[model samples]
Target: MTHATELTVIHVPVSDPRVRPLLQELGDEYSRRYGKDAHGEISRYPDEEFTASHGGVLLLLLEHGEPVAGGAFRRYDATTAELKRIWTHSAHRRRGLARRVVTELEREATARGYRRIHLTTGPRQPEARGLYLATGYTPLFDTEADPETIGPLPFEKHLPATATHRATHRGKAAQP
Candidate 1:
């Protein structure tokens, strides 16, 4: 196995301006590659939406102080959470940053009492599908009609009960 320096992942508050630019870049790249309108969809959710409701947590991953990935989790119900806005910069692809981001998000979801996590991605995003599958996410029913649906795949992952307690304690210890 190849051993690289351990990457540091930090949570970016929804209020950060860096989030918009990173998200815009992710959308623009997706649209350019897939021949669809993705930037508009990403712009629909603003900082205010995340702050106003206790609906979810948005995080940006920085490598050596440069933002490389972003993802969020929105509560669907008491036991379920939806992973949204998952994206990694083109420059940062194939480095396993996406998988790390998803794992962190899953840990966060568990800490918030979420027992299951779900997400949907367009068929054009093959890399994303692979990451989800590799990370233990299973295919689920697709209920919405997506514009870029090469059959947009829906996935779900169940969280073990101990995941939340462990993450919560770890987070508390990490805090100054």
Candidate 2:
């Protein structure tokens, strides 16, 4: 087994050859948890949504130089990013990789000038929900529903503005 210390993280295409396995596994698991019919929703994300040039980003975690954990984010609004596709290989669970991914994603968004992030995880993914909560996300809903009964758990977090954010906003003075 490759040690966590040996893992390397890099930004890559959502459809890159090296990152396909992680994305496929994420889709397959979502299919199983939601149903094969849900494949439509799983596959409907536009390609540009994961393209950095389009105000989006995808990150891959490589262990022994192979993709293992991954996640992505896309612009949600002028100042909000939407996080998606967070996953860690089953063998790599409990290793804090997901938290690292979330943290990095937040930093990436902040660097890109986003002031907040919004995301949703299916109710069946309690671990994902916990990861977001543990990483400073606030639930959008008033009540937490059972994983088996709820639709999806929505969460949001406001990123602390970085120099990039401040610089970008410095020009947009409010109209009097």
Candidate 3:
């Protein structure tokens, strides 16, 4: 018997067919929330950015072998990873699945020697902002009026040095 508590997350290519519908749903939600222009800017993530060898990853949270939620991250700099596409099925919200995806992605970043994680969520996604803050991420751009960026509130999380090797992507060690 599989309880919802036993949901599994697997890393896959961002373009995997299993995740296509979820992406469409995400697109629809974005258009509904932030209007079309912003949605257009935010759609689509490149595949090479989500493959493992490049220190990028895409994850799908599955139940009974079916995708329920998803997220991804890519090498941002030598020491930083940029998180993206954190989405939960409308039927799956409030289930903690998105949190699990974020936690797993962070672990993957740490495992690969990333020292910090960066991400952004649109103003329409108050829940996402709250999720990040609740999970210890700090907001990066709060008071900038008339921001030039067309999408999302930027957030960052500095990972503790718990791995045998610090991340190589940063080109230099991050100051503690």
lDDT of each: 0.72, 0.79, 0.80
Q: Candidate 2 — which residues are off by over 4 angstroms?
A: 1-5, 147-149, 171-176
RMSD of 2: 3.4
Ranking by TM-score: 2, 3, 1
Per lDDT, what order, best first? 3, 2, 1
What is the C-alpha lDDT profile of model 1 across 24-82, one tens digit per residue? 88788778877897878776666544431565788877767667777887766657788
Instruction: Give the 10-residue window scoring lowest on summed lDDT in candidate 3.
Output: 167-176
lDDT (Cα, tens digit) per residue for candidate 2, span 76-141: 877888998888987788988888788789888888878789998888787887788888899987
For candidate 2, the 10 contiguous residues with the lowest summed lDDT are 167-176
CA RMSD of each candidate after superposition: 6.0, 3.4, 4.1
Off by over 4 Å in 3: 1-5, 37-44, 143-151, 166-176
Error of 3 at 102 (Å): 0.6
What TM-score does candidate 3 reach? 0.84
Q: What is candidate 3's lDDT per residue for 100-134, written digit by digit as tens?
A: 88989999888777889999887768789889988
Error of 1 at 145 (Å): 16
